[model samples]
Target: MPQDRTLLYAGRGFEVAHVRLHAPQGPVWSDLYTVASPRVVFPIGRTRLDVRSGDDTWLTDALTAIRFGDATAYRLRPETAAVRHSLVVSGHASVGPTHGASTTGVSVCLMTPQALYRMHAARRQLPDTDGTQAATLVASLVAYLAGAPHQAPWHGAVARARQLLLSEGSGPGTRVLSLDELAEAVSRSPFHLARRFRQQTGLSLHQYRQHLRLASAMERLADGERDLAGLAHDLGYCSQSHLGAVFRQAVGVTLGDARRVLGPAGTGASASARI
Candidate 1:
């Protein structure tokens, strides 16, 4: 009489949770899976969303839907900066192109089912009174995905600085622009720009630059190329050991260890190997 829940994705730093509905006469499982990205967002027609995780409960009426965003858009921060939030889609829902919808508003990079379930339980006790429970849940999710208190404003020089970080390759990778050049490109005073970059992105210009460098390293490691030393030098590390120290301190693991774990799984084991 009820739909079946499922685990769509699981990784080192992310996980996607899902539930499929086959209303006796509704869409068939084949029709549902045939959609573009088997891993995508689904919209609710007239059904309700009833989520129950542990001690939490969240509900939503028709009109609530799910979608995806680019995980490559993630910003690097201190490991201690992670913020956890819960997502629960109520009622008939489906998948789309890619990514999953946490709240109708936020795009959560599925962390862990255990974590999601826990948050679901917490959400139940905090339903919205404005009749837009779905919106509330999603808003909370978006905030969490945004690095919480570190969510960069949509418009600001610092935000622009962060945009620069996530866009294309930089520093150790292919970005040829230097700090002063980018500051000039953004038309902000270097001193002021550095301060704002710190306030907004939660790191200095130099530090965020390292973030990009680290991201690039992770990508290389995931390739399973086995050129750790070459990858390090190419990514701007003074040497293999230099990259190893920074990578371990920032990513929580050694370059070799991450490569072995990811083994081409694309699980962000690369992220953990980055400097």
Candidate 2:
């Protein structure tokens, strides 16, 4: 595997780096690395890698954020040839689990659509200075993650259902299956799937799908997509107006404002959106 990174910002007590990994045609293992300072990572782009910290393993992707504290040792083993992008924030001492401050292991959490959008926009802008601004952003993000509730491990049908939903619903052009379809695909009754899914992830099926659609919209808008009507249709919305309404309600900014800031060669415009 070949990996590269670029330092985007450096501050008094925190710094941000954009890291990328490129794997060969087959599975590969990276050299062991140890964390020297507390850090949080926001995964970007398409990602599929098993993070091994001691005997525990965690799967990380676009919808997940990972935190590692000082002295943590870990390695990456990619199951296939792929490219991955991530934002690594180091020097922040409070990036550990929300419940307590044991810095020896890893903490992974599901990122809400708004949180993911903020991270994606930040990566797109790639500010090279302004430590004060960077620190503020990092602190806001850490606090948001800390407040978000965590779920216990999910398995069996619930896990399979989640996998199907994320994989199929994340695309800009893919329409998510209906509840009946999803339940059948996951080998469970609709009622059973609905209850178990909520119990496992603390989100209804509809809510999770909405998150996927919104995340897709943010990613494309950040990439400079301008066709609101087409984008809405592709994402299974009734129309452009429908998408606009939901986007504003969830992100606290209009689509036009978001596009202006997250467009190609963004002007570094900041939004009042939730951090």
Candidate 3:
């Protein structure tokens, strides 16, 4: 089940969307620690909108604190057709239910690091915005979100666990995180720890581990530093054979095939394509 990426075309406007997504509820990250969704941004369009949350907070593009009043939308309408990436960071907040191929009509597309860098660099000529300068703010918001990281969390311990994985790679061995060990590190009992971790990350322990492992593997493959055997060891798989099964199943590509995504990477099929 992938997120919706269909571009909606109406009489006077259209939405170009792409981005990877995981809900606040689900085991989406059960495999290994997962990479936060990559950054995907939309260009600010012709109609600037004033978005407000139920809490009375003005919805800015994701960069600001999401309460910066009118500074959330960027007002830039370039004259030509140069492709640009705007960061998005709305919709990720607890919004509402979503289903099928129909667009739920929200904003924010988590972009990959590469996409973020590109968007920031584009700022050199295009200028910067919080979320309000545009006639249309969605693109501006997409820009604001493009370079940001997803740090939203209700509990500190779960975030601490994620930070550890981020700073130290996956685990002791490929597939090697135990609940008791994680609890010890986070200073909570196993049951309480697991519950909080799941609630914060929207994933089970096993799923989080697998997601982390795969993200690590993706990084290694991009660097052209390992074959199946080495990747397995680096990621703690039992052997190259075991690695093959999990790797393909997790990423939808064989180890050999993943190695080729290096140049231009993932076909520039913006994370928007996934949303």
Q: Top lDDT: which candidate number?
A: 2
Q: Name the better of 2 and 3 by TM-score.
A: 2
Show model 2 residue runs off by greater than 4 Å: 26-33, 75-80, 98-104, 124-131, 151-154, 169-175, 269-275
lDDT of 2 by residue, 1-275 (tens): 57798988776567788888887755556778888877888876645566777766665556667788678898887756777777888876667665742344677777877777677666655562344554576667877877666544334777778768766754355666889998999899999999998876677998877876787787678667999898888788888899999988877777777777666755544532323
Task: State which candidate, 1 or 3, has the greater lDDT.
Answer: 1
Local distance difference test, each candidate = 0.42, 0.72, 0.39
Worst 10 residues of 1 by lDDT: 72-81
The TM-score, computed over Cα atoms with residue i paired to residue i, of candidate 2 is: 0.82
Model 3 per-residue lDDT at 117: 26
Candidate 1 lands at a TM-score of 0.45
lDDT of 1 by residue, 33-72 (tens): 1112323233212233333222222222121122332221
By the TM-score metric, which is better: model 1 or model 2? 2
